[model samples]
Target: MFTVTPEAQKEVSVFFEGKEVQPIRIFIHGGGCGGPMVAMALDEEKDNDVRFDIGGIPYVVEKDLFEAGKPFEVAFNGMGFAVNSSLQLEAGGGGCSGCSSSGSCGC
Candidate 1:
């Protein structure tokens, strides 16, 4: 399951109000140097996606890529919103050479 902090919910609400339909929050995995990455976006719904609500906002994850054991959190940082995985370092497999432990990769 995933959770959205109160601040994040407010941020998302403000961001999506002008968009068509309800925005769908996408959680993408596996794309960095170490092979897994985290990416977020709002887009139209796609087939085979898992849709859920957090604080009344719509969120989606690719069904095939979804891991039942993963823990996730969404929060707001200033004007931006961020998502985090609560999995251990080992569960992340390994750090990307271009990605700092903080999850910022210049690459």
Candidate 2:
């Protein structure tokens, strides 16, 4: 299932306040020091996508990814949207062995 909070809906609404709106695509973003994260971006629908419409906004996630990350939710945190899901990633898949907290690893 896919869900989006009212606050998150408003946040996206405000972003498109004066422009044409596009569907928000949820997908695997990157595998950095923190690991691969689910992220959102403006995109069009695709043949393999699963779509959800919430609060007048459309969200789409690839079919396989939607199944892997079942029961996804989007909520507005203080600063921005936070995506929660049941998807699991392998530990240390991105390998941060020598990375430091001083932004040296570009985390």
Candidate 3:
């Protein structure tokens, strides 16, 4: 199941106020040092996707992905949209020698 908090709903509504509304696609976004993260995109629905409606907004996710990340929630984290799910992602490897930052390296 998918849910959108009122705060997030309001933000989304404002974002689409003067534009054509499209279904929000929730999918797995490959992460950097943090590991895989959930993300949102505006896209057309596919045959293999599962759809959910929250506060008049349409959300779509791949069937297999949705099944694996069941019970997802979309909320506003003040800075941006935060998608929460039960799916646990394993962290990526430690920083490489070429990485510039000592903390959270991209390489």
The sequence of per-residue lDDT tens digits that candidate 2 reaches over residues 1-107 is 89998889888999989888789999887767767778899999999999998877889999999999999999998787888899986635445654565645566
Per-residue lDDT tens digits for candidate 1, residues 1-107, read 76778888887787767775474655655565556445578676678777777766778777755564256677788956666774332325454555664565444
Q: What would the TM-scores of all predictions be?
A: 0.63, 0.85, 0.87
Those runs of model 2 whose alpha carbons end farther than 4 Å from true positions after fitting are: 91-99, 103-106
Best of the candidates, TM-score: 3
Error of 2 at 5 (Å): 0.9
Ranking under TM-score, best-scoring first?
Answer: 3, 2, 1
Tens-digit per-residue lDDT, 1-107, candidate 3? 78999999999999999899899999988866566789998999999999998878899999999999989999998899999999897756542433465764545
Every candidate's lDDT: 0.65, 0.85, 0.86
Ranking the candidates on lDDT from highest down gives 3, 2, 1
Candidate 1 residue pairs in backbone clash = none
lDDT (Cα) of model 2: 0.85
Number of the top lDDT candidate? 3
Worst 10 contiguous positions by lDDT, candidate 2: 90-99
lDDT of 1 at 10: 86
Name the regions of candidate 3 deviating beyond 4 angstroms.
Answer: 95-99, 102-107
